[model samples]
Target chain A: MIDIELAFENLPPWAALLTAFCVFMGAFLTLTGSVGLLRLKTFYERVHAPTLGSTLGTGFILVGSMICFSVLRGRLSVHEILIAVFLTITTPVGFMLLVRSALYRDRVEGNDNVPEGNPTPGKQSAPDAAVQQD
Target chain B: MSASFLPADWPFVVLDWSLFIAQLFLGLAMACAAYRLILGPRAQDRVLGLDTFYVNAMLLLLTYGIRVASTIYFEVALIIGLLGFTGTVALSKFLMRGEVIE
Candidate 1:
């Protein structure tokens, strides 16, 4: 039953253990990232959390899967690289856009703590402005 | 049902146990991401949560692929990866520019 059946049956003990280690480590890293996402206090801080899973966590899992399939089929299976490349390429772009957008929004609404960005209208010129609004 | 899935020997036994562990962790991680998605204070935080959710889900599928010993799962994972990127990019673009296309 080629793919539908249990293919790991053909894998050797060494490769099986290696694959297991890789997959477990990846899952653990991903869990750590999720924990970080939940525990971080600020938005910017939270933004940093998911990257752990996306980068190294995904990397490890893909590697493990590659090894598992390669050993199973008796060939070098590396198509999982498509997912990896997409992850590496798109994660930073999306995050950069999201963070920049978030920053723009915060600045537009006059967050004085954020460094000035072309002074777009609502500058919150002084702490008095922030206080007076309250 | 369970017996059919179990391997006949030891090395594969280690793998089965590890796959179980990996699945458990990934599921919990997905829950954490979902929690953030539902409860985040801001729209950006929600988007961030959504991003993490899809990535975790993709990896989950990959592990499932290895567990089932199917390359078909790779296609599913690839689709998720592609969709995840497109969705996040569009949402973030909308967030940043206020209009997705303009």
Candidate 2:
């Protein structure tokens, strides 16, 4: 069909190749992040794995998709850009909050693995104890 | 499909093969993340697993878009990423503050 030809013809060979490469790379990174998430021994360490996929992997794939579509469409298709921006802004916040909460819970449970900070009752200093007593 | 569309020569074929291999590796990564999500000792670990899953899903969507030469896949990927981020934040807040409603 002429329509099909027109669409296929519009895509330059290099663009197609690049798109494929980008897609592969994106998938590869995501896969690696998942693997890292599972392989890591701790929750804190596990959090780091997904970021690899979220940050650079998503970036590369989005760019590649944008380029492929823009070139093929012969126009700037930027809706995907919004999603990218949203993810970038939110992923970190989510990760930080989750980490903080985990820390809080661990501390509350008196888990030995959590780092030291703001001593709890019975673990506080004399001045802190006096203040608490009052 | 026309002969021209079939892609001439062995080199391009080799490239495609390599790219396929790359995708396989990425898939492996997703499996790893899933394993962690399922095996984690705590709820945080599951949340982390889900977060990683979302990131990986986004990338996977991109790859599908590229393979199919469609822009729609990219949009889906973006949405997944956004949802993943929000969901992770919510879960974390619940874990930390003990109240997701707030």
Candidate 3:
């Protein structure tokens, strides 16, 4: 219902085209990342997939939006950069913890898919039963 | 007030349509994330789901900003992204250590 136009009047044709390309590319990457996250077989794999979206996808789209707005409004529009910064900084920490937890659970139940690491002796590697679920 | 600078053809039109389509795609991504949260065999999957949800929401807001041609939307979206990031970190740390405080 809301109709927002692309104000490309002032700028040359090339800038608009570039912005469009950036937006579409960003959207495509984000879509791919989400699809990969859903389709990946294992938890670790899924954890890696969405990072594509959080990283490059967010970066591209935010850049596109910022450019479009700045060109249209005739002023700087760099606030979206803050979102980019926050996401890039925090996403890895969350992902690492999630992976660690999954690894912990697998080891507690003795799963083979979970590779053993030198975290804690005897409890570090997942037992056999955990791997069966995989 | 800014109409003097406005182009003969409304620029918001292109931006809005593209953003609407983008929002639809982002919504689908959120749904996928939600599925993982619900069907997660373990608690970690749920946390991942929640984390994905937050990111998708932030992106959606950016698209909305494009739709409205207002920088205000971007600010709110930025805040949400920050809050979501912090919340996810806290939840994930809790899962890893069983105590978020430590």
Candidate 4:
């Protein structure tokens, strides 16, 4: 096993403190998000839970990582930024697709909990209503 | 060593304690997500649980990398993030269209 003391002996006090703070916050947020996911009743509510992790949870952790590595190597290590960017860009898209698909399936199954027809204005037509009816 | 910038021992102590606590929280998060995945009443709930599990796992990996002072795990964590998102997208697509491909 790698010795923790030996590995981090060179870590400055400020950097160590920052890393600890970031990691702690990140982990706490993730845990809260997961707990929310488990406790929420509906799939739509649950869909909102993981966003906590994908957003702030991921942001804090990646920032902590960047700080730790940059301080340890005595050089800027910003590669973890890639993860933050990728997650920020993709998470909403994924969630949007998932929620839309779930709504579509629910509507197709005639689940009354979800609103039927185009709730949007300027797009109401008999053919669309007919398609939904059939 | 840039330890000259902050010559103090308290931060290291704080770091050790916080790292342990963070790991504990992350583990609990993973357990919660697994519970949802296993006990979900609906398929979408299971998929949502799985997505949460992946994100938690990736965060856990980042903590592990910090603990070990290794950057290799960063790449692994990145891959997990990318692949996890892709898997969820595919799963959602399959659910929506009844198939992944047209």
Clashing pairs in 4: none
Model 2 Cα lDDT, one tens digit per residue, A26-131: 6667767776777776776777777878777777777777777788878997877787788778887787778877866765565656654543434654433444
- Report the poorest 10 consecutive residues by lDDT, candidate 2 chain B: B9-18
Off by over 4 Å in 2: A1-9, A117-134, B1-23
Tell me chain A's TM-score in each of the predictions.
0.80, 0.79, 0.80, 0.85
Ranking of all predicted structures according to lDDT, beginning with the best and ending with the worst: 1, 4, 3, 2
lDDT by residue for model 4 (A1-134), tens: 66789889989889999999999999999999999998887787788887998899989989998999898999999899899999999889888878877876776565656745563347654444654676
Residue by residue across B1-102, what tens digits does model 4's lDDT show? 566765458788899899899999999999999998898887777778888898899999999999989888889999998999999899889887789989
lDDT of 1 by residue, A1-134 (tens): 45523565567889989999999999999999999999998888899999999999999999999888888888999898888998999999899888877877776575655544433345544433554565
Q: Is the docking of candidate 3 incorrect, acceptable, medium or high quality?
A: acceptable
Give TM per candidate.
0.86, 0.78, 0.81, 0.89
Among these predictions, the greatest DockQ belongs to 4
Q: What is the DockQ of candidate 4?
A: 0.72
- For residues A1-134, what per-residue lDDT tens digits would candidate 3 score against the true structure? 33343334455455565566666667768888888878988887788888888998798889888787787777897777777777877887777766766776667756657665544445634443444354
lDDT over C-alpha atoms for residue B100 of model 3:
88
Across residues B51-80, which tens digit of lDDT does each residue of candidate 2 receive? 876676666656655555666676677677
lDDT of 3 by residue, B1-102 (tens): 567776644433444456666777888888888888898777887888888877877887877666566677777887888788778878877876779896
For model 1, how does the per-residue alpha-carbon lDDT over B6-100 read when each residue is reduced to its tens digit? Answer: 65576777888999999999999999999999999889999999999999999999998888887888898888888988888898889877889
Instruction: Write the number of the candidate with greater TM-score, choosing between 1 and 4.
Output: 4
